[model samples]
Structures are given as structure tokens and as C-alpha cells.
Target: MKELMKGNEAFAEAAIRAGCRFFAGYPITPQSEVLEYLSRRMPEVGGVFIQSESELAGISMVYGAAAAGFRAMTSSSGPGYSLLQEGISYIASAELPCVVMDVMRYGSGLGDIFTGQSDYWQAVYNGGHGDYRTIVYAPSSVQEMADLTVMAFGKAEERRNPVTILSDASISQMMAPVELPAMACHDPDAPAWALKGKGNGHFKRHTSVMYYMNEYDGYVRAKYEKIEKEDQRWESLETEDAEIVLVAYGISSRICEEAMRSARAQGRRVGLIRPISLYPYPVNAFDGLAPRAFLSVEMSALGQMARDVALACGMRAPVYSMLGGTRLYSCSDVEARIGEILGAAHGAF
Candidate 1:
């Protein structure tokens, strides 16, 4: 069975399918539909839905709910996400598990109700005040938006870490028919690894870093190092002997994909690496690209992931980027940039 659903609504449905019983959030577009959709459905299913005072308070409540050990989540956009980073870091530090869906819009300040992948760095790089890390899943389509949100909860708890669903305005607003997956009686969203509550179990203690250099320095490095070791994923398209590659995640990857198709029409051999998980970024994936590959790092932001890709690729090939401009990106934009990179591709290998 399939139904045409908004990306945000699908995300809520997917959380339900994943057995997410507790949701705490502050609404902000274009992700507000997700928050609003869940608000009604959760109570109908005997789940708890909380609309908190602010993004900070919302995630703080999420922290409490997650501490109590219910498969929990929250949703927001760029500005809202900025507000929630404090709690996100706290959740990461305490090693409490939760899922967050950042249905991004175009903005570094204020807010734009339009499409963009500008939050790529903020979501993956742990854009909070202190040192922290989380797993980020970028979804290109509405179906993926729903499915990824559900999977994020499971993966977050599996690692006893936070998992993020990264979708953009286009995907969130687009209507698509998504087939919901059937779930078993036993829900995997809330796993045995988390501390549910003190009801059947003993009370739990939660704490955050107090910034003692002597006490926290080594632990910080170890946690960050551990994060770097796990949670990296990428998808290879036409990668076999592909000389020049386009690297992107989220909605930008969709454009890159179409660009590859167009380039192929003109008989240009282009490849793409669409990273699914942003943190513990797929560095090794780029390393294995064909020698002539100069990674075209595409995003709607000002060269955030590009810098990371360059660090990952080193001198194997140049890492070029097309970033920071108004308006939604398209396959034509990708084609032009890729044409530029290919023009200079020969000597780099």
C-alpha cells in the first residue's frame, strides 16, 4: 500500500512505525508539519507528545525523556536546530540515545522557508558550544525522510549515541507516495541498552561536562576519536573508473545524481559519492575514487563539507566545491560545475 504524503508527515508516520512513544519538540518550518502531525497521532496511540517552551526547553525535555528510556525524538529547522544544539551536545555527552530530524531550510541567520542543504556542517560537525558528536543521516526523498527518521532512532540507541535525520525544504514539502513498512510486535526503537526509567529499574544519574581540563581532556579525545571510527556511509554511482566525481549529501546529492545522468547523455563519465551518514564521514570512500577524480563537493552552504572533503582527499586529487549562492540548486548547475572540473581533469591523476 502506498500513499501520497508530505515529507514531514511521512517522518511522523515513520516514527510511529518505529514505535517512538515519546516526542518533545518546538515547531518551526518547514518542519512544523512534522511536529504538528505527531502531536495528534501520538496521543491516539498512547504515546506522549510535548510542545515545549522553546527549542532549548524542548530538547531538554527530550533529554529527560530519553533518560527515562522511551524511544524519543524532536524536529526543527535551521534556526530551531541552532537553539537545540546545547541539548544535542548534552545528549551526546551523557551517551543518551535519541533521534532528531533537521528538516532544513535556506539560512545561516533568520530563516528561509525555501530549500537548501546549508545545515550539512552544523548537523554533522556537532555545531554546539562544546565538544560532541552525533550520527547524521541525509535523506534525498520523502520516503527516505520517513525511513531514515525511523532508522535513526534504532541506530542512535544501537550505538548509545544520537542519530540525526537530515532532510531539506524541497524534500519536506514535496509530495510522494511512500509505502510504509510493516513492523513486528516487539519494537526495536527502544532497546535494552538505554535507561528507560527507575520504575522497574533503579534511578539513573545524568551529567554533562563541567570543563575541567585535567579531568575531561582525555575523555573528550577518546569519545571524539570513537565517533570518528564509527558511523560513516556513502553511495557510489557510476564509480567504476570514474575520473571526476561529484560528492554531496541530502537534497544536493539528488541534483548531483541527475547531473550525472545529463553528463552521461553528453558522454561525460562522471561519478557521485552521496554520503548517507555525515559524521564519521565517508573519508575512505573518496580515497578509493579513480585517480583522476577531483571531488566536486556541492552544497548550499559556504564550503563547509568542501573543507572536510579536501582534508579527506588530501593530494590524491583536488577537491573543488560549488557552494554559497541563493536559490535552489539543480542538475544544470551541477552540469556546469562538473564541466569546469572535467576541463582540468587530465593532469591531476
Candidate 2:
């Protein structure tokens, strides 16, 4: 059965279904609903939910709960997400499993509560001080909010690292029908490294000291390599013999798809590549493609994802950007940009 749900609430409900027994987070616009939903739902499921005094405190609580072998999660928007960096670094260093969500809002320093995709660099590049990487998922729809939240918890445990759901204000607040996953239970004693009480003297857990070990470098390298090789995910549309391919994710990709369809209807060879995973970056999606140009569509003024597209395709062709700084542009706007790029390629002005 599908229920009409908002993206934030869907994500929260899905977390509980995925066995997320502990949640700690502060209220922030565009994502506060996540905390609110979990607060009421957690106790009903016999789980724990805490509305921490601050984002820092919330993430710290998540770290402690995750270390105890429980499925834990936290969420916030840009500013609050910034505060979790230190705790996220600590969790990464400890190799603990947890999930985090960034309901991105616009701007750099205290950007307004408008929709934005400007956090691409921060989330993918690890804003915290560390030699670490967190898996990032960019969802374009409300259904994905539910689906990916469930997958994130599993992936976090699988990799023993934090996984991030990178959503924008549009997706977070939009209402759509979603068929959520079934409820699952997680055992707190499942992980060998969990901090059990004194009765378990044989197994001890140490965190944030991996750098001191001789093999730390090799271990970290291998882990990320495997993830990069096997975890890259994307959705390619009509790229078989396309001369132009548009790359985007989240709400931006939704608009790009519309543009691609419009361009194709007019007999233009346009395609789209929607990245599902942002960190590994879905570089494999570019394999065996030889388009004349690549266009990066984003909601940031700087075209933050354009560079990654260039790197993935090895600059085989020119990469263009259709940027929407603080708001979404129409499909016709994207089509106009494509026209400009095509005209420039043909030296038509």
C-alpha cells in the first residue's frame, strides 16, 4: 500500500523500518520534519529519539549509539550539517556505522532557507578534517527518500562508515505517494566491535587511533578503492548515440530530464545521466560514451558538479553548465542553454 507522504517524513519512517533504533538531531528548516516525525515514531517502535540542544550534541549522541551496535541516524540542513563535521570525522575514524541526511539549503555562510545544491563539494569532499570518505546518495523524488533511507542504513553497516542522503528543500517538503519498506529489527549485539558492558572482557574497541597503526594507510586505501569500484551508481537515458549528454542529480536532474525529452522531440541528440551516488560519482556511467559535449545541470551558481563530470569523462569533450543559483529553472530554460551550446559548437554565434 502506498501512502501520501512528504519526503522528510518518508525518510524518517523508512529509517525506523530499516531498524534505525536510535536517532538524535536538532531542528533545522527543510529537515526539521524528519526530527519531528522520528520523535513521535521512535517511542512507538521501542526505539530512542532525542531532540538534542545542538547539531553537535545530536551527532555525538549518534556516535555513542552507533558504537553500541545500534542502527543510528541524524539529519539537518546546511548550517546544522556543518556542525556535524567533527563528529562525522570521529565516527569515520572509528569505523562506526551510521547514517546522516543533509537537506541542503542555499548559500555559503549562513545561506537562507531556500533550496540549493551548493553543498556538493562539502558532502562529497568531506568537510571535516580527515582522510575519509562517506557514501552519498542523491535522491530526486519523494519515493527515493523512503527507498534510499532504507538502503543507507544497510550500506553504513556493510561499509562500517557513515552514509549520507543528500536531499534538497524541494524534495524534503514535497508530498508524494510512497510504498515504504517493511519493518526490520536490528540486534544491538550483532557487531563484534560493539561496546558491550564489562561482562565482555575479551573484546575491546578502540576508535580514532587508526592513524597510529602501521597498516592504517593501506587499510583505508583498500576500503575506498573497493567502494569506488563496486558502489558507483547512475541512471543513463538515451545516450546510445547522443551528441550531447546532460549530467545532473537530485531535483536538478528532474528538470534536466524534461529538457532532454524536449530536445529529443525537436530531433536533437540529447541525453541525460542522473547520478545516484555522488561520492564514487558514478564514473562508470560514462564508460564507452563518446558524446560531442557534456552539460552539467545544477542548482548552484558555480556548477559544482561540472568538474566531476569533466574528470569522469576525462575531458573527452567540452563540458557546459546550466546553473540555477537559488531556484529551479524551467525545462525551456535548459533547452535554450542547450541551443546556445550547440550553436557555439557550430560557430553560429
lDDT of each: 0.79, 0.92
lDDT string, candidate 2, 263-314, tens digits: 9999999999999999889999999999889999999999899999999999
lDDT per residue as tens, model 1, 56-156: 99899888878767778898999999998999889987778898889888878985778877887789887886667788888888888777877787787
Error of 1 at 197 (Å): 6.6
> Any residue pairs clashing in model 2, and if so which?
none
TM-score attained by model 2: 0.97
Regions more than 4 Å wrong, model 2: 209-212
TM-score of each: 0.89, 0.97
Candidate 1: worst-modelled 10 consecutive residues by lDDT:
184-193
Runs in model 1 lying further than 4 Å from the true structure: 184-203, 209-227, 346-349
TM-score of 1: 0.89
